[model samples]
Target: PVKDSTAAIGLTILLFIIPSKLDFLHAFDKDPTKRPTKPAPALITWKTIHEKMHWSLLFVLGGGFAIATGSTDSGLSTMLGESLSGLKGLNEIMILFIVCLFAENITELTANVAVANIILPVLAEM
Candidate 1:
């Protein structure tokens, strides 16, 4: 596997440029259509990307990061950690079970990264 970031990115660029230049993907076309006498529209364009982008999901994730930062800066994570520190006396399996249950429930309401960002500092303290 390529471990270098630059090499990985270079490989990705080559894959994209090579296919576009050679029309390599046409080999896999399942829909055989008549050849057009006139030019056809490009498959992807700036307008297509703009309309297809999920702007709301970005904002939701950004908000989640902001919340995580606020919680850490405001010592909410410390407080939460202190509250859960009592669990040190509990069995490791019980602690793991509780964490999984909490994560499972919270994940239903938000993105996984959002939950991780919010919970990481608290877990670190614990």
Candidate 2:
């Protein structure tokens, strides 16, 4: 909602600071005996990175990028576009509608960024 760039930056900084301050406050106990005696775990420790993180999503994203790059490099997308070029004769509105439908379906199968990377170049060539 902030219109000024400086105001937006200040708001973002505050957003991060406020939650962190609150969390730090909550970390201490009213009874000294109940408080943590040792330092907290490091942010980038192997336990945090390997055990806590969900890594499957990263693999899926990497696969999507690989598929996009392969399709482009192999010229499969260009061939696909040329094969579908007959659709160019249709009304512009209909073409838009069909492309949107195709995109929606493709996104259901894979990540949207991957689909866009693969489809946009083909559409551009067409």
Candidate 3:
């Protein structure tokens, strides 16, 4: 029910911290009707953790966040806006369409939210 970022992060952390003991792999019986009242003890192992964790994806997302933070901190977002000032003579629709294409291409290589953070400021300044 909560839409707050802090709440979202807390809930995500809770899934790991609170449910770390649940043996989800062996939670239910093989038969469709046979079910355990509670999950078995967790079978924690390095291999299991490795298999379950999205480690590489986490780095990629971190890099995206870093890129967005860096661009904002370095004033590149504002510079982009200023640079686009010269293109004022161009059709507004064309300008937005071009920006959208650029954003979409960057997003294909990284994360869409990161690209949005990088590009939204430029559009706002315009």
The residue-by-residue lDDT of candidate 2 on 3-118, one tens digit each, is 78689768655554453223344356787775555554433455545797779887888788888988889987887788769888999889888888988998998887788888
Q: 2 or 3, which is superior by lDDT?
A: 3
Please identify model 2 stretches exceeding 4 Å from their true place: 1-43
- Enumerate residue pairs that collide in model 1: none
Ranking by lDDT: 3, 2, 1
lDDT of 1 by residue, 1-126 (tens): 667878977865555444233344444566555333344344444576589989988788777877777877898777778887898889989988887788789889867776787677667766
Candidate 3 residue lDDT tens string, 28-102: 668645545675433354567689999988887888889899988999878887887886788999988888888
TM-score of model 2 relative to the true fold? 0.56
Error of 3 at 81 (Å): 0.9
Q: In model 2, what are the clashing residue pairs, if there are any?
A: none
Runs of candidate 1 with Cα error greater than 4 angstroms are 1-46, 107-111
Worst 10 residues of 2 by lDDT: 17-26
Q: What TM-score would you give candidate 3 relative to the actual structure?
A: 0.57
